[model samples]
Target: MLDIRPIGRSMLNKVPEVTLVFWLIKIMSTTVGETGADYLAVHVGLGTSVTGLLMITLLAAVLAIQLRMDRYVPWVYWLTVVLVSIVGTQITDALTDKLEISLYVSTAAFAIALAATFAIWFSVERTLSIHSIVTQRRELFYWAAILFTFALGTAAGDLATEALGLGFNVGVVAFTALIAAIAAAYALGANAVLTFWLAYILTRPLGASFGDLLSQAREYGGLGFGTIYTSLAFLTVIVALVAWLSFEADAGGKPEASPGA
Candidate 1:
């Protein structure tokens, strides 16, 4: 069996430290993912097929750079994540819109994919902790899991808000409550790794719900800000936060480096 213990102290892992800023940026990136994909597909007249291909290409390039890096580079890592989010959203959108698949079916499919990814990852690596993402194999698993989470989030969010008639605002509230409960459970001594992954998965839907709430038409239970404006605003915030993290890292106040597994 693969060893579960932390590895050498000097080796740097590719992922960032889990902190308040990390969560903040993660939510913002997810929101951008939702709105950005909509903007490109609808407003920009690219259609889901074209937009998906473009975003997937970009995500592939960015991920290649990220994988080649020796350590956690804030800008590269977050850019890859943002692109992944967009591509993941487009994936679900294509399945539901173009293929005419039901949101319920897509959600169940993505959930199964995520669960299988986790099971295989743990079976091979002996750990699912982000802190143990040292080997290239583990990093591949991590990215695969992240992609499925975003896709699952898109399907689940749409299923709740659109298919179930709960509306965007209600979906946001429901997901927010779930995340808060997860946080409470973690505080009460829930398994750290489990709680972390649960919260991570839930945040994608929460952020996507909020994205629709802000960007959809007023008649559609939203604020009517529209996708373009909402995407730009959230993208600005994401850029600012990533820049701050980069500045901090350059100032010799880098986040704690994860040891190799």
Candidate 2:
């Protein structure tokens, strides 16, 4: 029925090497993920556990299909990302809502999970380079880390807004500033891998806070746009970007690293 092959020494056809556009799209996607998850849970009348379970099931199936494919396809890659985004948002929501876990505790827990994931990933692959994600093991680690980032982002964002007494708009501004600072650091001799991962982690909270700012009601200190509107706007932008990239450039931009290098 389905081919379940392990990735090996062959070259990787990942969606794109990390670039400015890549980060832009990533933040947009994560924001959509946050809003979309909230929409499903609240607007659709599905509780957090139900929504999380449903999204996780769907993500699992999509990931299975993605893993089955021998090479990366843009649509497939983006779809997988979208699903993972929802599931990741659900994870944090479940912990915070259902379990009554504090934001700081969830943040610490997710941080530990992410760190453990990286340790195992590096120990197994002997390299944490995103360009080298040609192996099934590497891909698994990558996805796992991504899921953790979203959860960690949710917790971290909540901590900033709630625990730290910064409102949503202020949180967004703070995270935006942090991201800009990280970019500057990356430009000034910081390790590419380190900077890339650091930025990757930061973008999650940045996007999540922005999503809340756009989607939540004004009484909640947001713009009162609603989740559906926010999701639609972000999805539309994402689709446009994908379509443009498909026709204008290759699936992704120029290669970051050569195969087998």
Candidate 3:
């Protein structure tokens, strides 16, 4: 059974700690996001509209559970992320594929929206730091920013790989390099919060490109692993990691408290 119970903790931050495992799972989740969305929409024959509606409904339910929680719960947090990824991908695909909007236009629009969200969030909270998510309002702002990031990432990724003709292999490498540069900057004393968000955004495209490399046919410069296998492989790893995190939390691990702005 899904445990929706809130755990005892001193702080109210509802996000996981920034760690290597966190990034590992995040990248894989994006991979699953790309492939999973494709599988359900195309291969499963639900079509994009039906897939989008189904995923949105599921995301609403999971997000409600997440909002009700008083503190971070690994499973809940990750589940919300996965659903958001799917919904985000669907949002981008709808605009680009159905509405026939230019990728450049969608990318810029999402970017402006994300910047506006951050501006409003910081104007109200005085902090754009994830470490300060101790209130419901801040958490809401965080999720809003996250949703935009995923959508922006999807549009940007598709623009680069498909529209720009970079292809999957080069897309993965370019995004990976960009993230590495960001990490190096952070290590050299850049703002932690900014670096974190930058990396988080890039990882989505990097993972998506990697997913395509594995799932697409060899003629398309991919390995032909197929969407089902690619999604399943990444999802298995995600589930195992979440299980471990939950076990540790249940064993009385006091997660890091929310830091002040």
Candidate 4:
């Protein structure tokens, strides 16, 4: 287990504490990512290509700001995450939709990419723990892993639903159960870092499945809430959560740093 402590009064960690709120916001951000990308691409008439470019540009700008920050800033960090989620979805969409790549191919490719990233990161840093993401290099690895997880999750979710005919709600239940099992294992002394990453990866697909369940048409297995409303509603909640975190930070409440880097 990681030791919850303030690393220093002067130097705060780069990532937020892994709390319930962190997971909540993460799931919500991913949901918004799926629907937001679709909203801009389809509803706004931007198309996938143009939306991809725009979102990538925005992600780059936000990531630059996040990298420049000295410590964890909730709004900036979550904004970068939201943008990354959107761009990640667009990346998989390009591969599968435009290039006509198979979901299985994309899923395998992304899994390999993520594994390579972890291998290189562990080789260079000697650790794959998120709690130790205090340097630029580790942060780079962290974000890269996050991007790949989103792409992989998008592909996996689509593979289960569209390819395997699992349907959106079923995918949600499946991923949710998997995550619960992981959590239970963690509680029973499984590797914390490994379990954390597994849960993180799983959350992407879980959230995406739920996003589709809400935004997709009833005929297509969703509840009939359009992409626009779903995206907006989730975005609103994300903003509120981030705002509260920012306020808490300003009030001298800092997230505890996990030990055992």
Name the best candidate (by lDDT).
Answer: 3
Model 3, residue 58: displacement in angstroms? Answer: 0.4
**In candidate 4, which residue ranges exceed 4 Å CA deviation?**
1-11
lDDT of 3 at 74: 94
Write one digit per residue (lDDT tens) for candidate 4, span 50-159. 99999999998888888777689999999999999999999999999999999999999999999999999999989999888877777889999999999998898889
Q: Which tens-of-lDDT digit does each residue in 119-225 have in candidate 1?
A: 99999888998887677778889999999999998899889889999888889899999999988998888888899888988889899999999999998889999
The global Cα lDDT (0 to 1) of model 4 is: 0.90
Name the lDDT value of residue 164 in candidate 4: 98
- Put the candidates in TM-score order, highest first: 4, 3, 1, 2
Q: What is the lDDT of residue 176 in candidate 1?
A: 92
- Note the residue pairs that clash in candidate 4: 3-259
**Alpha carbon lDDT of residue 88, candidate 1?**
88
lDDT of 4 at 37: 94
Where's the lowest-lDDT run of ten residues in candidate 4? 1-10
| lDDT at 233, model 1 | 95
Better of 2 and 3 by lDDT: 3
Reference-based TM-score of each model: 0.93, 0.93, 0.94, 0.94
Clashes of each: 0, 0, 0, 1
